[model samples]
Target: MTGISGGGVMTERKKKYGGLRSGQTIAICLAGLATLWISSGAVTQTPDKGAEESRAARGDQKILVRVRESVSQVRQSYVTVFGRTEAVKKVNIAAETEGQVIARNIMKGAWIKKGQAILQIAMNDRGAHLSDAEAKFEYQRLAYASATKLSKKQFQSRIRVAEVLSNFESAKSELAEIRLDIHRTTVRAPINGYIETFPVGVGDYLQTGEIVATVVNLNPIRVVAHVSEREVTKLRVGDKARILLAEGVKREGEIKYVARIGEQETRTFRVEVWFSNSKKVIPEGLTAELKLKTARKHAHKVSPAVLTLNDEGIIGVKAVNKDKSVIFYPVQIMEDTNEGVWLIGLPPRLTIITVGQEFVQVGQTVRTSRDEVELKGNSTDFNSVKSAS
Candidate 1:
């Protein structure tokens, strides 16, 4: 009975140990499964983190900017210059003979034609002198005729006939002098123009070669401008130009003269444009602006805000290529208007960066948001672009 009890106790202890070993195996498996679930959760979050990192890298690569798709239009290029109006011709009328002024025919500012009498000088003894000279001329003519008849008949000596002929010529010269003196008493206009100044009036004594009046012709007025050497070569004598005068008055004129040589001091060529002033309303020395069309070209109109400078300090605009790479194109300002600045020397079609151009660099890849460019009568208006998401 002692042997049986010892064996039972040992068997019972072995069973208990076996049960403990099974429980330990189960706990180890459960711990392993929990570890696998945690690893799977980490693996699941890895893809999200990688996606976030990828998006952040992409956002850093491209810079957002506003752009405008530009289509160049045909435009006329012009060279503008400041100038002033000038009279075509001016004359200073002088007295031809010494006399006392008796009557003034025209007013100080009257328009007079050629040969119109301006002032009348007193005759004085000119009429009496003319009559005396005429009588003497007739007497000498009769004596010369008698002597010539006698000389032809060989009855008078050659010396006497020569003397008589000399007397007749002398008297004829005297009569002509008297007639000329009488005629010179009236001062006439030398050209068809308006009298700008009349220094002398009625009862004013005048000497020969004294200034009596100043006449200026304004039928075809002229605008005189100085142009640079680069612009002078494109101008022709028949080219048309527009002139802006005081009070916003604009007139069309034809190029009349362009200097072949430049001025020594300023190195500028002189240009003249002629236009009609039929009413004589346009005065001389008035300020003017000349707009001379040089040529027709393709141009794009953009706001001044779109202009930028390159690394080399060149004035240009930033554009995007087909591949969305930033590009710099040098541009020349064709004109500046109230609406926008017209730019030339650009591609016929372009995608120009409007905003955030300064933040970008040449040859850099960019993301662009498009803005609308509205056109209204040669003016460009840019609409705001929305922020990129």
Candidate 2:
């Protein structure tokens, strides 16, 4: 009985000890699982740490930017004005005498030279009358000479001498009238030009001062434009100009005239540019654009996007110093064009901020990158824009 009792107590102790060992093993497993879960979370956070390492620091983030270097260039400035082409001169050929046009050689739209005959008239009794007047005048002249000699010797009365003198003067006047009529029979061109209109034809009767033809001279064609009061002062006579016609014709010319007085209604002055049109290729009344050179300047060419206004509404651009610190400069526009703007009032050499300029203020140190020009476009990749190697 004692041996049985001892065995039973020993078995009970063994069972309790085994239960304790199992509980310890389970607790250890639970701890191991918790540790593994925590380790997995730490592994997931590694990417965030790496991202933080690559990112810019608090103050240092403000220091990097994209900038462009301003290069000085000699630029030509021009003032563009819209205008129209005009003929140098227009003329009207008129009849000098009354006559019937027997033969007509004029052709409208044909070239004509000075003294070129455009018509012919029938010669009637004028020529015969001219001869008859000359013969009578000669006879009267001889008679007058005889009468004057006789009077000098007191051979005849003074009345006869006076009558002969009157007859001679009458005859001379008659002859001159006939010659004038004969010369006026034929009409001629008075200038070198094109016959714009020829209303008279064969057998057409024309009176004195009647319109026969119209002509125009286009050589040295004129372009007429108007300049505003603000621009007229900068323009002068004989300044260089270029004319672009609507027909795709481009002609170089010089400013021939600038009106001193402004137009009352428009407040603009009339200006004229003369272009050589020896070929008569440019026609009158075509729309034209004239570019007149105003001045030449040493300036920097930049995109118009760089222009900005300060707090006081002063127009300027932002630039960077040698140390890559931001700076603000007031600039005057030397010229503004569709392609670009030429700016003045900056240092000879400048490092202007092209992108992120508005974000930074003056005196701030910023990182910079060069211009990465995309082909034929204005879009920029600022992040990828790094200074050229």
Candidate 3:
């Protein structure tokens, strides 16, 4: 038992000594690792690099970009609206006399001249009535003359002569009525136009005031359009406008009318533009686009690629200030054409950044590549860009 106890105590001392030695070796290995890291310059170099990068970010680096000097100019601009075309004069022909249609002079879609006969109705009994009335009128006229002559000679009473004169007047009125009926048998066009529709055909009997055909005068065509209340006030009679048809035809015209009152539902007023259609090639009810020159103003034309948005969600293009810092100016676009868009807000002379705008923010310093050629003219002339040194 004594030997066993002694062996157990020896085992405990051995374990304690072994633990101390392992701890000392671990401390020595850590010290070696620390010394190696310091000698390699990694510990000092890492923190220095982070500090250096932070300082450089604070206005230490410059972004490079391409820029141009854009200037605003006074130019003529127009307001374009899509609209529809209409005829200046449209009419419907109707039958004036009750008769059977014996002949139709022209078919629908035929051009007609003023006073040309369009249709002929049978004069049936009208001609015979006129002849009989004329004969009665002649007989009454002779009787009245004989009565007047006898009265003057004291051969007839005044009352009897007066009665004969009255009969003569009544017969004359009947004859005139019959003649008018015969004239109305032939329906004639009132104006020079084209027959749009013909409801009546040959041999068809028509009552008085029944529609016969529809005619449209196309010598002068009018384009009708609706303009909102905001733009209606700028339109006036005699203002020039350009009309473009959907079929790629273009016509120049002038404003013919503008409605004073606006439509209740849409709050838009009607406008009519008139132009000569001597050839009558343009048909009615065609869709058209109208462009009316509103007013002249100073504006800047810039490329669409240069446009950008600011932090506040405002749309504009960034420009380089004299100090090489970015300037964000809000822009109001006036017109957008194939060449470039015309904008209204910008300094008279501005250095606009084109490339690398997305990489920079407002008030950031930038290095710019300048273009040699610039806009030069009368209203708002462009000058050479300042030196980028």
Worst 10 residues of 3 by lDDT: 378-387
Range of the 10 consecutive residues with the lowest summed lDDT in candidate 1: 378-387
How many Å off is the CA of 120 in candidate 3? 1.8
Model 2: CA > 4 A from native:
1-60, 71-76, 122-132, 148-163, 295-298, 303-318, 321-340, 344-349, 354-365, 370-389
Q: Rank order by lDDT, top first?
A: 1, 3, 2
Model 1 CA lDDT for position 140: 100
Tens digit per residue, CA lDDT, model 1, 273-292:
99999999999999999999
Could you say which candidate leads in lDDT? 1
Off by over 4 Å in 3: 1-59, 144-166, 310-314, 373-389
Q: Distance (Å) between predicted and true CA of 132, model 3?
A: 2.2
Q: So what's the TM-score on candidate 3?
A: 0.75
State residue 141's C-alpha deviation in candidate 1, in Å: 2.6
Minimum summed lDDT over a 10-residue window in model 2 is located at 380-389
How does each model score on lDDT? Answer: 0.89, 0.83, 0.85
Q: What is the C-alpha RMSD of each candidate to the true structure, in Å?
A: 17.6, 13.9, 8.4
lDDT of 2 by residue, 205-235 (tens): 8888999899899998899999889888889
Q: What's the distance in Å from true for residue 253, model 3?
A: 0.6
Instruction: Write model 3 residue lDDT over 1-389, tens digit each, in one string.
Output: 99999999999999999999999999999999999998998675435887666555644445566788988899777878888889898988888889999999998999998899999999888878988999999999999999999999999999999999999999999998888888899999988899999988999999999999989998799999988888888777898999988758889999989999999999988999999899988999899999877888889888898888888888899999999998888998888889998887788889988765766678878777775544223111111111111
